[model samples]
Target chain A: MTETILKVDNVSKAFGALRACDRVSLDLRLGEIHALIGPNGAGKSTLIKQIAGNLRPDSGRIEFLGRDVAALDTVERARMGLGRSFQISAVIAEFTVLQNVVLAVQGARGTSFHFLRGALSDRAVTEAARLQIERAHLGGREAVRASDLAHGERRRLELAMALALRPKAFLLDEPMAGMGADGVAEMTGLLDGLRHEAPILLVEHDMDAVFALADRISVLDYGQIIASGTVDEIRAHPEVRRAYLGEEDAA
Target chain B: MGRETLLNAAIALGLVAVPVWAHLAGEPFIITLTTKAVILALAGVGLNIALGHGGLISFGHAAYFGLGGYAAGILAHHAQTFTPLMSAPFIIEGTKFMPVIWLVAVIVAGLAALVIGALSLRTSGVYFIMITLAFGQMLFFFAISWPAYGGEDGLVIYVRNEFPGLNTLDPIQFFALCYVILGLALWFSHRFGRSPFGLALNAARQNAERVQTVGIRPFRLRLTAFVISGMITGLAGALFADLNRFVSPSMLSWQTSGEIMIFIILGGVGRLYGPVAGAALFIALEHFLGGVSDYWLVFVGALLLLVVLFARGGIIGTLAGREVAHD
Candidate 1:
């Protein structure tokens, strides 16, 4: 098997009496699109949050590139080439789309504090930002304010921002949550292309997009993985059908 | 090419021309008033870094402003007495100039910012505001209680400090000095807003979690902005001491902090020239209203409430409208 880029070992999280995440274990491999699917409140976001270093799990270990990263902060993990796109659109509303992407490029370049020269005037930073924007199909939208962009374009901008980091792996949460048919197709095509570059762990509810794009599918129920297998195996599994897909597939 | 640059240059030119007109028209008081406006505006610009761009409501900026004023005052007092600042450790005397006083002010304020920011950054929202206010009150009391160079009474300068080859005693010339520094501070604030570090600071304000996920520490970025903001305000304080030839505990009061915040809000929060516009309006209001009635502050307070309620953006913001870029 290809080397595992990420390993979550028996991670559990609790808040008061609720076990938000319970002993969830998973492995993500190199250059593969792995999908984590579940009903609402099934703890998929919580798991993603833990993996992205936003929240610490009560009991678990996360290993990335052979080192345990449970103690690392979010930014430190990002600097180590871990990129995450938020479930909510979190672009700087006042900044131009190009400026937002440039910030990410600057972060990856490790020169966020260079004060004498204007960041806009820096040729290398702008060029890299432009390249990432183009790669994410946001070529013409560069001059628009992030707030002015359409919801789908904003989602694309978030992806462009993540790509700007030149990340080793991507943790994407609902890239297609609010997209229409055209938006979904465009984003699916983009993700399909990115699968050749870095490992991607996507948390999505769009089963059609998930099955079409994911190399491996994991069904999460009540903060626990009920089933994990290839598309065919997940489609054939009775437990997954009883818990999630039975009603939907019947319709 | 950007609208921000055009507006900043326009304000700078207006300020530079004011003293020239004062010099020609034989109105020396105009020059003094202009200098006062410029100095206070520069202080506002400093506060704008934390409040506008960084989204840090530092209600205690008067601490740095007062510290700067005291540095100039204490140094000038010791220089006149022909007393070394320290004899047992080493011999250190005081010199009066725009540069030396500014340096001392910047260093002192920067150090204080480091300590205050470390503590204040621990909390956010209302807690942050209260913590900063608490720190400002602490310094205000300390300045009032210390019986060194005037205490509650105030310190008076026999002569204005000198700048190299500039005569320094002429009111118009002094106005020109303050105008140039204000212009520089405005430019610095504008440039800082567009820098990479500035982008992160703005990002942190918008979304702290997003910034962290991108691999940037929010606290460190904010702390850096806070220190730079304090240093800039401190420089303005040094000039302010020379403006009135006086330094008092009132300079460090919470009222002073509120006034600085008012300058940013009244002009247009986060706008490049917001502080300048706000400073000009505030001084003009003070001059005009104070001449008309002693109850002018009541009107000022009413106007501030109006701005906070109806006009979310200050005067420049209302004039410029919401489409103006502010980060």
Candidate 2:
């Protein structure tokens, strides 16, 4: 049997009175989009945070490529091939798009302790970053500041940065949240091709995209995964239909 | 030439010209005054690394400055008396060599920054500012209470430390020594500002979480910046002590920190030559205004208020007209 690329084991996180994630278990296989969809306050963001190392789970283990990552911080986890995109658009707003992606490229390598040489002059890293930027369809906007970018463009820039990391697994939180109709279609096509490079654990509210891209759909509700199966199987699942979809068909 | 480069060249020339012109005109007082300004300018350069580039508003930099002064004063004092610094298994005698004094001052201050930065970097905003200030106050009060050196009175070196072939007693020669160091530091700062590490640091200042996701630890970058800041400021402190032949606890005071901050704010926060212009302007204001009335601070306050309200980037920014892409 082929080992899963990412494994999240019985992760549980509780706020004083509210349980954010309760014994949630999932696995991501290579070249597959495992879409996790839930209503508001279903703990999607909290679960993503745990995997990204932004928050510590009360009792659970996250393994990337078969290595336990409980001790690693977000940076260390990222260095170990766990790429993440924030729910909110997060980019170095003061930096140009090229500069922002170049920083990600520089970090993709080992420690960036080189103090004497200029970063812009490092052609290899800058060239690689340029490729990712182009891949994200941001070719002509290289010199534009991140702050000045449109909402959809910032999302693309975030993808450019995450893709630059060359991660084995992607934990993207609400990647399609703020996108407009055209932006959504464009990003949907991008994420479709992206899964061929590495497995993705997508947490999005876009059901159309979920139906289009997901190899498997997991319905989350009130800190628990109510159901998990292929899109066809999940649509027919009574608990998922009753608890989450109501009458809006997933098909 | 670019605006920044032209401004930098002008600053370097102007700082050097003031003392040389003053010496030839037989107004020796101006040379001494300029020397003070240059040394303080170097200290401001040091702070700019952490404050401007790193964006760590370290309000307690005077701790490193005063520590550097004490390093020189303590070593020179021991050397003059021909006493060993310690007498356990080995006898370590102090030397009146300027280079040795500088090395000691830089190391001592760097270590102090490491300790303080390690603890203070964990807290940010007003908490970080206060922590650094508290550390500075601790050192200031400690220096005042320690009677072995001179306590409140401060320690004095009878003669300035030797600088190999140069005449240390001659004001112009000493100024020349300090001027060369300032030049080297400015070059280093320019190189460092362009480095990849510097970029990551600037990024960290803007967003630490994003920096972390990029696989760079913002804490380490900030800590290194703080240490480098301390080392450079410490060297300036040693030079300043040599100029006055005095090492006082006042060097570590928060007032000294405020004055250092004023230099950066008045010049341009992140601009490399910002501190130099600021220090020169501050010294000029002091020398010219001190003769009029002792209430020079009130006017200084007014000018500072004007700069803060009208000029966001300081003198260099005003002269240069625009900001560079990366800075």
Chain B TM-score for the candidates in order: 0.96, 0.98
Tens-digit lDDT track for model 1 on B1-327? 555556667777887787789899998988888889899999999999999989999999999999999888878877777777667777888767668888998999999999999999999999999999999999998888888777898787668888997977899878878887887887788689878888889988997887877778889999999999999999889899999989999999999999999999888888878889889878889889999999888888888899989998787677666644433
Candidate 1 overall lDDT versus native: 0.88
Our model 1 lands, by Cα RMSD against the true structure, at: 1.7
TM-score, each model? Answer: 0.97, 0.96
In terms of lDDT, the poorest run of 10 residues in model 2 chain A is A242-251
| Cα deviation of A64, candidate 2, in Å | 1.9
Candidates in order have lDDT scores of 0.88, 0.92
Count steric clashes of candidate 2. 0
- TM-score of candidate 1 versus the correct structure, residues matched by position: 0.97
Q: What tens-digit string does per-residue lDDT give for candidate 2 at A1-251?
A: 75599998999999998999999999999989999999899999999988888899999888889999899889899999888898999999888898899889999985367777988888898899999999999998988899989999999999999999999998888889978889989999999999989899999988889989999988889999989999999888999888888758644
- After superposition, the stretches of candidate 1 with alpha carbons farther than 4 Å from their true spots are B1-10, B322-327
lDDT of each residue in A1-251, candidate 1, tens digit only: 79899899999999888888899999889989999998888899999988888789999899987789988888889999888898888887878889889888888888878665788889989999999999989998888899899999999999999999989899999999888999998999999999778899999988889989999999899999999999999989999998999889889
Question: Cα miss at A249, model 2 (Å)?
Answer: 5.8
